[model samples]
Target: MNQNGSEQKHYIDQYLREDRMPHIWCPGCGLGSILHCFLSSLIKSGIDMDKVVVVSGIGCTGRAAGYVKLDSFHTTHGRAIPFATGLKIANPELQVVVFSGDGDLIAIGGNHLIHAARRNIDMTVICVNNFNYGMTGGQLGPTTPLGARTQTSPIGNYERPFSLPYLAAASGAVYVARWTSMHVRRLEQTITEALLKRGFRFIEVIAPCPTTYGRRNRQPTGLDQMRYYRENSIIRHGADPKDVDIDLNGKIIVGKFIDIERPTYSDLLDEVMQRAFGTELPKDDTSKEEATVVGSAPK
Candidate 1:
């Protein structure tokens, strides 16, 4: 209650589907914090909430779409990006966001991720990386650090994990950034910035999965991993993504590593249509321009 001693409701309550309340995340899991930051960012972004759509694939983080009170799609495993792509292409005015876990996005949906970035699709992707497949009994995943023990890697994981920022940058994402669930304010700010940007924006959040992943990896609780992030995280804005490789219990370099501009897929498509035919589709008033046809081909 405020000083007036009147009933009050949390701002997030308006954005949440209360019927889906009591989320499914485990104790000490970082999904709650990540979700809060995302919802807060949506408020700070000054976007038309009615125009926003959230898409998710299967995983613990994928449950985010189901809980939010927005136009959302809980898609099949690794198919969130493609579904989001279709939505954007069909209705260019909608703001599409892909929120899912590392296993869903980096493993099964890896191809869609790279191609979406390559195409410079106008959408934002928020990937919560818990370092393992949290929804699947803490199995080894694409982003699980080398030597990290999980259900599948009893001894240690020998494979190298992909550097997400590097992958996004190389694939042509116009904006790429990363932050841990511990960095709530910064994460919220970054998400807001990504929301306002155009063309393939990616933000990776390193969250703790204390229930399944932490118990076996020495981080017995969410607080323990939060402390680890507090002590070991280094903010290095503009650092080369290739140089930022996370290791188990090692230093974490976190910051906005890339921001650039390029024509979005829709923009290029419009140009092609103008070239093929003497007419073009109507554009938004904000981006409207006089049309010119240097040459035309048979439609």
Candidate 2:
């Protein structure tokens, strides 16, 4: 409850919507920490705040757009990526970030995610993966581990969970990483790196949903899940994404999986436009060609 203190001056409040205090996330939930790391990264990224756009879809994490004091948008379920895509395409100088939940991003927005990666759009996606839908009660989600119990699967989960890092890498993401919310320092570092990287950057954060997934799965508290992460996580940088799936009570592989440069969507489009028109594009558009590509480099 300490406010207006001298030490609190550097408090991570510059990017927050102060009027929106008392966030709606459940107690011990990791969304708050994720948001904190994100804000911290934004501060460290050194990107022009005016050129940064925060986008989110419907979920617990989607509320991030509403709380951040920046150019933010809370879009429809699973559509934050596409919306941010348009923003980037319209203004290539903008640093668009899609911040939302795993269910909204992987389950509902899976198609958009793949296409965006395939196209190598210049954007950062921070997926807060709690293994279930945290906002609308604890229902099973795409990232829920096999054999884990959820409201939709009380006895046990039968479907295999998707390894998001693998999906993003395979989909052609220039940079892909995963970390538990407990790894706040590392998470902040990754986010800052992703923000500065061009092309599709995907960061999957395994956060705790103490009220739902944890209670049903025996953790019962956020600290227990965090402890599980601290003990079980293996930091294997550049690990094979295909072998990084999250299994029930299995070791979690966490690190930067892939980072390779290629032509981004904007880079390709600008080339086409210039050749077709036989004239240089606007000054703002010219800079995009020299940055943020995901495909083969131009000769």
Q: Candidate 2: deviation at residue 252, Å?
A: 0.6
Clashing pairs in 1: none
RMSD of 1: 6.0
- After superposing candidate 2 on the true structure, give the runs of residues whose Cα lies further than 4 Å from its correct spot: 1-10, 280-299
In the range 105-200, model 1's lDDT, one tens digit per residue, is 999999999999999999999999999998879999989899999999999999999999999999999999999999999999999999999999
Cα TM-score per model = 0.91, 0.91
lDDT of 1: 0.92
Clashing pairs in 2: 262-293, 262-294, 262-295, 263-293, 263-294, 263-295, 264-293, 264-294
Best by lDDT: 1
Q: Return the lDDT, model 1, position 178.
A: 93
